[model samples]
Target: MTRVLITGATGQVGRELVEVFADLEVTALDRAHLDVTHRDDVLDVVRRLRPHVVVNAAAWTDVDGCESDPERAHRVNAESVRWLTEATREVGGHLCHISTDYVFDGTARRPYREDDATNPRSVYGRSKLAGELELDPSATLVRTSWVFGRYGSNVVGTVLRLLDAGAPLRFVDDQVGCPTEAYDLALTIRGLVDARHAGPVHVTNDEPMSWFGFVQRVAAAAGGDPEQVEPIQTADLVPPRPAPRPPYSVLDGSLLHSLDTTAPGDLDRAIERVVAAMRSTVKR
Candidate 1:
């Protein structure tokens, strides 16, 4: 069995990774156990384990919080990645790090490609880009957008919660991107890790739509009326968001095909599964 070391194992993606890699020899660790920002500690852990692959799923993902604390964001997102790169090198292991579509400044009319020029507009995006720069082409860099999953706080869960409570749904129509199911993404990551794929790659669900449409889809999947979702512009936000999200973040998933792979099945099917699973837990 392939030995895999996963950081941020408690996160949405991290949790799904653990579940998907159940057959493998996996060592999953959370921030409390392994503070990746500490260089010596990260090096010590990797050097000791010497796993075949080290999946760095840990990240400071609070976009607005990153804007307020740029230094902390760089430390966790960029500096920690440098440490992980060095550690993985010491063990002669493949490093699979997760990245965001936020690296691209939402200005492209066409889908963003792997080689597209990146101009991140917010502190969080800039920090993530810095981390991406730390890796050589030998490492696998997966850039995804609008990621959601069953294990953590995500837009999917948020929508379900609001719908269950009979709350209003207001979403921005201007910002568009792909929604990635974490379980499927984890499966792709496993494939990449097994193949020891190198270079930057984009992975996301099939459909590309705006946030408003996405919320409506979620509401519909949860047995709520899609029309109940209020469409609003980004500028109409009462208290403006701290970080500026990309207006268009649909990635060119064609890169996955080049790697002899493809995105998982239909996005609507995935959404329905998530909705069913979430609803099952609701108290009658």
Candidate 2:
């Protein structure tokens, strides 16, 4: 039996990972059980569990918060990953670290390749990129974008809530990226772990869309009026954020194809699934 350990178990991706790896001897830990910022606690847990695989799903994801508190972001995103990597190395366990498409500057005319230069504009992206660099040969880094799922707060949920409240929705049209489903991303990670594939990989849905388009799709799926969702350029939504976001951050997962890996669903199907899941939850 392969023993697998996951941090940020209560998060969107981590929650999905627990469900996907349910058959395995999986130990899921949330912030309370495993505070990644505490090096001693991280090392002690890894030494005791001695898992064959460690999936790090915890991250400082608040884009604006990272800009205000860069030190905390570094502690959570970079330093904690280093500690986890060291612990995993000591235990002879392979690490799977989650990353983001924000690593790229989004200036590419097409999707970003694995080897493309990363010039992250935000503190969150920089910290995540730093974590990726720290892992090197010992870990597999999976970069994804526009993540949404049933387990936690995501774009889909926010859009639905706004629609329900009859609040006018305004989404940025300038930004574009693959809207990845957390469940699909989690399953892809499971495949990599099971197959023992190494190195960095990009896993996202087949298509890319602007934030406005995504909201339109979500609204349509939820039986809401798509026209009510307004599309606006990022520039109009100022006071401007503390950190800069990439205008285009789509990641190409062609490398995963060589490894015989396939993304689960496309954007349309992912939206349908999210809508169905949300409806089911509401009915319950």
Summarize candidate 1's per-residue lDDT along 202-277 as a digit string, tens digits: 9999589999999999888888999999999999998999999999999998879777754566789888888777
* After superposition, candidate 1 runs with Cα above 4 Å error: none
Tell me the deviation in Å of residue 159 in model 1. 1.3
Give lDDT: candidate 2, residue 58.
95
Please provide TM-scores, in order, for all candidate models, with all chains considered together. Answer: 0.97, 0.97
Q: Give candidate 2's TM-score.
A: 0.97
Candidate 2 lDDT, 7-76, residue by residue in tens = 9999999999999999999999999999998999999999999999999999988889999999999999
Clashing pairs in 2: none
